[model samples]
Target: MSDTKILTLIEAVTAALDHEMGLDKEIVLMGEDVGKNGGVFRATDGLQQKYGDERVMDTPLAEAMIAGLSVGMAAQGMKPVPEIQFMGFVFPAFNQIATAAARMRNRTRGRLTMPITFRMPYGGGIHAPEHHSESTEALFAHIPGLRVLIPSNPTRAYGLLLASLRSPDPILFLEPKRVYRMVKHEVEMNGVALPLDKCFVDREGDDITLISWGAMMHETLLAADQLAKDGVSVEVIDVATVAPMDMETIFTSVRKTGRCVVVQEAPRAGGLGSEIAAEIAEHELMSLIAPIGRVAGYDTIMPYAKMEMQYMPSVERVVEEAQKVLKYV
Candidate 1:
């Protein structure tokens, strides 16, 4: 509802954190460098100054300690937002997240709830060191009792963060490090928080539907624009929440376009795209006019800064897949 301006995705994330901390006294932020350094990406910039060190305390460089402390804090009636720095480093705390935080409510029979939010910058594109850029959303999504929300744009990033903080269950909030400062869009806090299970249709067309999320949304949009210039219409859908996908939107788009091409930065084998492709095949087989295609990263560890682009999905790759699916009709 306001004029659009250039704003970094990290700014959106910081704004959401500040807003939530101010709105809820029980909400607190903790992680390495989150206090003084304001996080590696500066996503928590100035929070320690605003909320004081007690609430925004900086912890040891131990992922497991961060996760365990957050779980205990959440169980004690406080909402703790823990930053994992990078997705690659999150493996150290996988057991705490999977066994303790995620299963707390069920284990306690509703007597205890772990309302902790795990924030991690993920996906390749920034040309960072090897472990710094990884798409681990699918790994977290595979775990039950945890909500996974990955936002592509500024508005959704802000809204989804607010929504995740207020959620009753543990949330895995993955931000695309590549687009953290690339695209800009005006964001208003007046908008309602988006549900965790919903998907968004960025563009509508009759030719083919491009399903994607996280950083890949930007490339998907570029592909759609290129196809538009070539006299081909394309629809773009953002699966903002990978765990509980918006099946209604996905099914409707496939039914209308009759073709789908899922794009993701994760590896092709057993990736989120594979699950989506399977769901579409099982439910919308009759509605689809062509076999669903997937454009994803190769099945290998992300490479160094120079070869990072080769490990993730690119605009040209998405465009080629769209063309292949479009030709099926």
Candidate 2:
């Protein structure tokens, strides 16, 4: 066990990678500016100095090549954690991810596995340019073999990333860029890995189940507090594993609360929220007292600067929606 100290989300990420790389020689970190620069966000800061260039590698600005190289390394028994800079930039690597990395296991009938962790900073709250900010977790989650995990805080980010590296299949580790340094918490440097495909109960309440992941989890929790002050009991669940979701956890909560409000930074159509809503409708329909409410981004492209705030689902929006759901008899 290691002594716990308060650290930012990015610091926790760096510590996890450093700890993992120290323990596993086969584990390698590669990306556009990951080497001497310590990644674009410095999440890999000080790693290159400790692990050296071979383990903490810097690659050309080729997104496809980065992922393709990772696939080959993974197939060859190397654990490659490749960062894609931004979710929007992940487009060039779609073929490698959707076609190669995702299908390798099934294509070979489980003989070989791609133990690769594709890390990317995602979501739009920093007013970054068009390609710097995108919340397309749903697009990647739709892929069959790729497991998607988003962490709301430093501790989970550390544990989940460690787990992703240990898994035999490919993983899309989308770090909520918006909350990277929003707050700090005491995180131990222990190398323990958290379980994947699970929903974590962030706050326990009985009035309603508030479900969300990634950067939206911050907003969801913020709204949960407001609802709490109003005498509404809200149970907040962070759907950390976006796909292969631990629906048992979600269904159980909805069954207890009889009402649900799902929030997402992504657009409404075809987002994970819709999938959750469908499940609630199918399995938990009888338990629901009100029609489920969804708080999500609009169908339009995320705008620039100040307008970005308008594009995302605000705290008020989540509160209002939760209140509406509570009103239904």
Candidate 3:
């Protein structure tokens, strides 16, 4: 038998935390229900039993306090990994994240660093309630001193979580909860960390480029397969790190394919898709054979459970948009 085990994204998270916590004595994990409860998704399951309460602490149900404590703990040379139960619950702590944790390194002229990893589950699906289904990564990505990372699969989840823990700066690690157990991968328990601020080319093609990250990657890859069956070659790119994006990879792919469609689960206006489209237009406009396309969530608020599917950009919408881009004269 191989020295690898099949693990879901959430299980990958737990494994990464367990492995890293065992290695680094300075690394402490704290958040509401993270100790005895092991997080709402059980991403930290059994860690408290392994490391005890002092290391795997359960904080009060206050987001701001959690963020503040992470900033302070990290400043004192401890690697603090804090969790905000859900993405929507983070706004109350945005000030702490944007002002303190993110800017601490630059603010202190590199004398002090906030080696903190803030974890939260984002995106819509699973029929979650109002605040539980927000995909506002753009909010954190826009901050000047923060790094925003979203992993699309179990391997990336394991690698990225390890990378974030080792980073000397603040990182917002967004987990796609919808696909927490949607698929599994055989992952070796190696301590290797994937490079940060890079794009992963999931599929290489010569026709159109399909770009997306987080849970939207699931639909984007499905659309790529569907398009391939129709004899349309699609190059798929996962923008793992939304902030400080590896635009050169995208530019190279678009220059080769000459057509591109960006899929984002966020709202259509003022989202990262618009940013990518604008950047491509600015840098690689003459190389384009057609106007860049985008398939994203509606501009209105993400609705309740029943209408969630209607609001999300489905595989059909992505294929339709890709076809339109390909057929454009």
TM-score of each: 0.97, 0.99, 0.98
Tens digit of per-residue lDDT, candidate 3, span 1-329: 42677999999999989989999999999999999999999998999999999999999789999999998898889999998999989988999999999898898899899999999999999998887887899888899889999999999999999999998979999999998999999998888899888999999999999999999999999999999999998999999989878999999999999999999999999999999999999999999999999999999899999899999999999999999999976
Q: lDDT tens string, model 2, 1-329?
A: 57897888888888888888888999999999998999989999989999899999999899999999999999989999999999899999999999999999999999879999999999998988877777899999999999999999999998998899889989999999988999898987778899998899999999999999988888899999999898989999999998778999999999999999999999999999999999999999999999999999999887876688888999999999999999998
User: lDDT per model, in order?
Assistant: 0.90, 0.92, 0.94
Lowest-sum lDDT 10-residue window in model 2: 127-136
Between prediction 1 and prediction 2, the one with superior TM-score is: 2
Q: Clashing residue pairs, candidate 1?
A: none
The predictions' CA RMSDs to the true structure, in order, are 1.5, 0.8, 1.1
Candidate 3: worst-modelled 10 consecutive residues by lDDT: 1-10
Model 1 CA lDDT for position 114: 86
Off-target runs (Cα >4 Å) in candidate 2 are none
| Number of clashes recorded per candidate | 0, 0, 0
Q: Return the lDDT, model 3, position 8.
A: 99
**Model 1: per-residue Cα lDDT at residue 312:** 76
